[model samples]
Each structure stands twice: as C-alpha cells, then as structure tokens.
Target chain A: MTLLITIFAAVICTVIWYKTAPKNEMKVGILCWMYWGASLMWFVDAIIEYAELGAEFFTPETADMINDSYLGLSVVALGLIIWLVILLVSDPKGVVRAALTNKK
Target chain B: MACFLIPAAEAVITTVAAKIIKAKEEKDNGNLSLTDIKTDDTPKLTFSRKLGWLNKLLWGGSALLAFEHIWHGEVVPYFPFLTAVQEGETAAMLAEMGSAGVLMAVLITTVWLGMLGVSYIIEKRPDKASDTAEETQ
Candidate 1:
C-alpha cells in the first residue's frame, strides 16, 4: 500500500538526517519535539475515531460527541504544530548544541 | 510496532544500499585503496540529526496508543459498530479505516525518509574534505 511505502521512506530519511546532522546545531531538537507532539495528537485522534466507529449509534447526541471530540483533538494537534514552528524559529541551533554547550 | 519495525528494516536496507553506492563510486574512480577510509569531513546535513530520534518516539507513542485502544477501548466492544450496520456495509467500513491508518503511517514515514535523503545529499558535498582534515589534526 501507498501508506506502507511512505512510512518506510520516512524512516530512511530520518535516519539519514540523524547520521548527517551537525554536532553543534539545535534544529534536530525542535524537529524531535514537533514529531512527538504530532504523534500524540494523531494517537488521540485515532482513538476518538475508533471509539466513534465501534459504538452503537443509539442517539444523535453520541455521534455529535464523537464529532466534537475529533474536532477538539485536531485543534490541539494544530496548536502543537504551531508551537513547534515557533521553537524552530527561535533557536536555529540544533538541540544537540544546548546539551554540548551546557557542559562548558 | 509497524512504525519502528518498518523504519528499522528500511535503515538496514539503506546501509546496504549505501555500501553498494560506495563500491560503485570506488570502481568508477579507480580508488580501491580509498574504500575503507571513513572520513569525518563529510558535508553537513541540511536537516539535523536530532530529528532521527523522533521516529523512535513516535513508535513508542503508537505502541502506547495501541495498548490504550485495546485495553481501555476494549477490542471486542470497539468493533461492534460493524455489526450494527447493514451486513454489506461492515466490510467496507473496516477496509476504509484500515486504509486510512495505512495512509497516516505512510505520510509520517515519508517525511522521515525525506529528512534522511536530504541529510545524505548534503553530507556528501565535496567541500567537507578541508573541514574533515582540519578536524583530524
């Protein structure tokens, strides 16, 4: 499936980046945070969607609740992405720099 | 988890691929003597290496999510919606959901792979030799 291929490709690219990054830069840290945030949001969204799908549709209210939950989680995910972008812009240095320099 | 396993598998493949490329480059350049040399003077990756850890983190997150979904969501109750629907509709819905999950995984992995590809290209830049030599001393 396209999904499998894309996921496989993403892993390759990430490893390549890891191997090639500068010891002094902080960009990698920001990216890591962003990835974690996105993953959390995605997990939440998936759970909500799965829950909605599996439950019996006894009432319209239940459907609406699931929809609202999905929307809310999406907003949260968007917020995480925005925050990551800010972190990325604020410190152009890779996070590795902070750890290294902290020793000095 | 599929996310981590898939990527780890890909990394092994990449290493193999890299070796093949290196071998080919050596053959073309007539530099068998230079093949075993590992130089730190490689050019900088356009993307940072810190990004690599994200894959592990995401994989962990997904595993947790799977656990939560199975334990908290209760697997048996989770799929009952299928039975509630018309007989013909259940299979289609399940298929659709499965497809969506696959798509999401692929999208995330693709971005990860793109970062790696960029890093490789940047690191191979010819200018890093001076930097490498300087670092060696």
Candidate 2:
C-alpha cells in the first residue's frame, strides 16, 4: 500500500520536474529524487516480503493496509517538509532572500 | 529483517564523504562569487553538490523505511533492536540482509549514477547553446 502511494507520487513529481527542467525554481528535482528513492526502497521491501510470504503477502489485513496507507501519506508529507527546509536554506528562487532584504 | 540498515550505513559513509570532499573543494577553489562575465565553459553544479543529492536520497529513504519498520513492530527499542535479531533468527536475518539489502543499495546507487550521467549532459547544454549561437552568427 505504501509502495503504491510512493510510486504514484514519484511519477507525478518526475513529470513535473521534467516539464520545468529549464528554470526549476521549486527544486522539484530534489523532490523527485527523494520520492523515487523511497519508491525503490518500498519496491524492494515488497519484493522481498513477497518472496518470503508467497501468496500471503498479497492478502494483508484490512486495518494494516489502512495504517500502512497512513504511513505512506506521512512519508510524503515528511519529504515535502524536508524539501521546504532545503528551499528555505538554499533559496534557489531567492523569494526568501528577496523578502528578507525587502524587510531591511 | 533490517535491510534498510544497509542504505542507512551507506548514508553515513556518503555524508562523511560529502563533508570531506566539500572541505577539499573549498580549499582548492575558494569561495564562489557571482560575475557578469560569460565564458566558454562554466559549470552550474559542483561535484560535491551532485554527491550531496545522492546523500540526501539515501538518508531520506533509509529514514522512511526505518520508520515503517518500527511502525510494523519489526524494530524494537530494546537491545538487539530488531525483533527478528532478538528472536534468535540471526541466520535468516543475516541472509535477508545480505541479499535484499545489497540489492536495494546497489539499485539506488545505480539510479544515482544514471542521474549523474543525465546531469552531466544537462550541464553541457550551455556550451552547446553557445556553440550553436556562434555557428549561427
């Protein structure tokens, strides 16, 4: 469940990053890499668990899947949080810089 | 088992490597300053910055997986830390780590290498653009 969510987010971000490759103000590339890395991590876990649990892996408990989905959402949110911090620190678009300078 | 540990371990190594390389680069190149002059060649991204991308990917991914493991109760706060390891399934855990962990680490590194290659091409674009501009003139 988490794997599905992460993969979806990764794909969406990758498309956006590709479209804005020329002048990427948001640094969507970082977001893309983060999400893709996570997607791969989950993919590997899913494969391994499937190998171990065989058919049982496919039939996860309903409540467990829901909880995993929530965790997936949290992971996406955390990635965005990290990206926000990076943007603030790097200020690639200089929005923060402009605002700070304007205040002075 | 705790396969994510492998990437977590790699994150630690790469983080240290980034710091070391960054220090060396600073000593070699000094501070960066903006200039209005345009030249035949100017790199937009540094080697350290590229490696920083890989480091961030590894660290962020590992942290998320670690959290997931904890959420599933595969990881515990007590000694041994991992429930499987604590249950005396050391052999199985080690096997899983050896196979799955290595594969995951290698897979991520391969992706990062491909990214570096793509970025290299992107970095060369300005030179290509200038060359075309000159040819047009």
Candidate 3:
C-alpha cells in the first residue's frame, strides 16, 4: 500500500511536471523525483517481503494494510518536507530574500 | 529504515538539475547577472512560481503530520530513528492511523487549491490597480 500510494503521488507529480516541462518554476519536478524515488524504495521493500512470505504476502492482515497506509502517508509527508526545505534554501523566486530585506 | 535514503538522494539530484536548468535559461536570455535573476519585480508566471501554492501546501501538510505523530507518541527520542509503526501493531490502531492519513492528504490538497485562488487574486491586484491608475490619468 505504501508503494502504491507513493507511486500514485509520483505519477500525479510527474504529469504536472511533464506538462510544464523545461519551464518548471514551481519545481514540481523535484516533488516528482522525490515521490518516484520513494516509490522505488517501496517497490524493493515489497519485493523482499514477497520473497520472504511468498503468496502469503498477497494476503496481508487488515492491521498490516492499515499500517502500510500510514507508512505510505509518512513517506509522502517526509518527501514534501524535504522538498520544502530545498525550495526555501533555493528561494528560486527570491520571495524569502525580498521579505527579509523589506523588513530591514 | 534505508527507505528514507531514496528521498534524500532524489532531493539532491533534483535540486542540482533545477539549478542547472535555471542557469541555462538565464544564460540563454542574456540575464547573466545574479541580481537580475533573483530580484526581478515582475512575477512572470513561470512554472516554478505558479507552484507556490503547492509548496505551501506541502510545508503545511508535513508540519501537521509531524505534530500529529508527536502527539501520538509515535516519535522516539533517539538518533537515526523515529516513528513507532512496526510489524504486529493492532488492526484498530492501524485503521485509525490510515483514516487520519487519508484525511490529511485530502485536506492538504483542498487547502492548497483554496490558497491558489487567494494567491491568484493577490497576484492580479497590482496589475489591475496600475491599469486603473493609467485609465484615471
């Protein structure tokens, strides 16, 4: 489920990034990369778990599914946080700089 | 877990790529001066600038999630470790967390849309006012 959710987010972000393409000012591309990276991580996790549990991995308990969902959400949230930090540091629009200087 | 490394790597790669592209664009446009690129007064509806709402949403949503996790005692006081969700948690607890997660995602996105609307109005206001002033003259 975590893998699925991240993959979904990655797809949506990618589509938005693609539409904008070489003119990305919002840097949605970064978000897309983050989610896709997460999706790949979860994909490997799922594969390993599958190898260990075989067919039983397909029949996860409800609690496990819910746990997976939470994990997925956490990953998505973390990705956003990292992206936000990057955006702030880069200040591509110089909004932060402008605000700082204006206050002086 | 090692999963976190993926996003960390992605962040670095994307940031570098973005910087490169921005530099290339500025060079192509002959705006080689750093100040000219950084201090442009006119908000040229560039793709990155338009994503301001999204950036805000992500920041807000992430902060909210972190707060909620802390409140739930999910975070532990240790280095290189956080969160308590491991194998063999109760089904009810997982369900509750899952539901909350879904709600968070939905609410964040909705709030982002609302912010986008507000920002759109704010962005247009200056232009409208300037046009009005010109007309009055």
Candidate 4:
C-alpha cells in the first residue's frame, strides 16, 4: 500500500517536473526525486518480505492493510509539507519574498 | 528494527561528500560559468550538483522511513534506540538490516544512477543538435 501510494506521487510529480524541465525555478524535481527514491526503497522491502513469506505476503490482514494505507497517506503528506517549506524558503515565485518586503 | 540506520549513515557520509564536492566545484567556477544547465555547447552540470541530488533523496527517504519505524514502535527515543534491540530481538533485527535494509539502500542508489544517466542524455541533446547544425553550415 505504501509502495503504491508513493509510486503514484512520484509519477505525478515527474510529469510536472518534465513540463517545467528547463526553468525548474520551483525545484519540483526535488520532491519528485524524494518520492521516486522512497518508492524504490519500498519496492525492495516488499520484494524481500514477499520472498520470505511467499503467498502469505499477498494475504495480509485487513487491519494491516488499513494501517498501511494510513501510513502511506502520512508519508505523502510529509513529502508535501517538506516541499512547501522548501518553496517558502527558496521563494521560487517570489511570493514569500514580496510578502516579507511589503511589495505589491 | 533499525533498518533506517544504514541509509541514515549513508546520508551523513554523502552529505559531507556533497559539501566537499560543492566547495570544489565553486573553486572551479572562476574557470567556467557554473550557473547554467542549458548545455548549449558544453554541459555545465558538475559532480557536486549530481551528488546534491543523491544526498537529498537519501536524506529525505531515510527521514521518512525513520519516522515510520518510530510510529510502528520499532524505534524509540531512548537508549539502544530500537525497540527490537532493546527487547533482545537482536537476531531478527540484524537479519532485517542485513537483507531488506541493505537491499533498500542498494536499490535507491541504482535508481539514482539511472536518474543521472537520463539527465546526462537530456543535457547532451542540445549540444548534439548544435553540432549537427554547425556541420550542415
């Protein structure tokens, strides 16, 4: 569940990054890379567990799946929060900078 | 139990490496314009900048995984740090670190390498186009 969620985020972010590839003023690629890296890590973890548990891996408990979905949502939210912080700090659009300097 | 430790450790090392490489690249900036990724004729992408990408991925992923482990009670705020190790489930924890932990780190690195390759192709494309145009002229 975590893997699927992260992969979804990665794909969406990658498309956005590609569209703004040349300028990249927002640094969207940073978030995309984070998601992609995490997706790959989760993929490895899932593969390893599947190897150990065989068919049982696919038959996870309902409660466990529910828990995983919550965790996945949390991970996605955390990524967004981090990206938001970066955007504010970098002020790619100059919105934050202008607000601070009282510019129109 | 402490699977995130491996990548966290790698992150620390790479963070240091990225700083040193970035410093070196800055030192070379006087000899070349290091502000552009356009690759008009020569690709300005440097090793340090590439390392920065890897460092961010490692650090961000490790941090998220660490938080997840803590949420699951696998990690703790106290001494010994890992709940499994504190309870003497050392063998299982070590086994996880050895297999899943190592594989996760390795796969992330391989993916980063693939990213670098793709970036190289993108950065190289403009230069190739300009060369063909010059040859025709």
Q: All candidates' TM-scores?
A: 0.34, 0.76, 0.47, 0.87
Q: What stretches of model 1 exceed 4 Å from their correct place?
A: A1-104, B1-37, B43-58, B67-93, B126-137
- Every candidate's CA RMSD: 12.8, 4.1, 13.7, 2.8
* Model 4 agreement with the true structure over A1-104: per-residue lDDT tens digits: 88889899989999999999989998888788778777877788888788889999998999999999899999989999888898889888898877889955
- DockQ of predicted candidate 4: 0.69
lDDT tens per residue, model 2, B8-97: 899899989988877776666655432212345565676677888888788878877887788778899998799997889989888988
Q: Which residue pairs in candidate 3 collide? A: A25-B47, A25-B48, A25-B49, A26-B47, A26-B48
- Which residue pairs of candidate 4 clash? none
DockQ of each: 0.08, 0.53, 0.04, 0.69
Candidate 4: regions farther than 4 A off = B31-40, B120-137
Once fitted onto the true fold, the runs of candidate 2 whose alpha carbons sit more than 4 angstroms away are A18-29, A50-67, A84-104, B30-39, B124-128
Provide the interface RMSD of candidate 4 in angstroms, 1 decimal place.
Answer: 1.3
Query: What's model 3's lDDT at A77?
Result: 78
* Total clashes in model 2, counting residue pairs 3 or more apart in sequence or in different chains: 0
The lDDT per prediction is 0.45, 0.83, 0.58, 0.82
User: DockQ order of candidates, best first?
Assistant: 4, 2, 1, 3
Residue-level lDDT tens digits of model 3 in B10-58: 3345446556666666676687533223223545444334344344444
Could you give candidate 1's per-residue lDDT for residues B1-137 as a string of tens digits? 12223333434554465566656666755766353334575534212232433444444334333333332332334445233143455555555445544454555566656657765766576666676998899
Worst lDDT 10-window in candidate 2 chain A: A29-38
Docking class of 1: incorrect
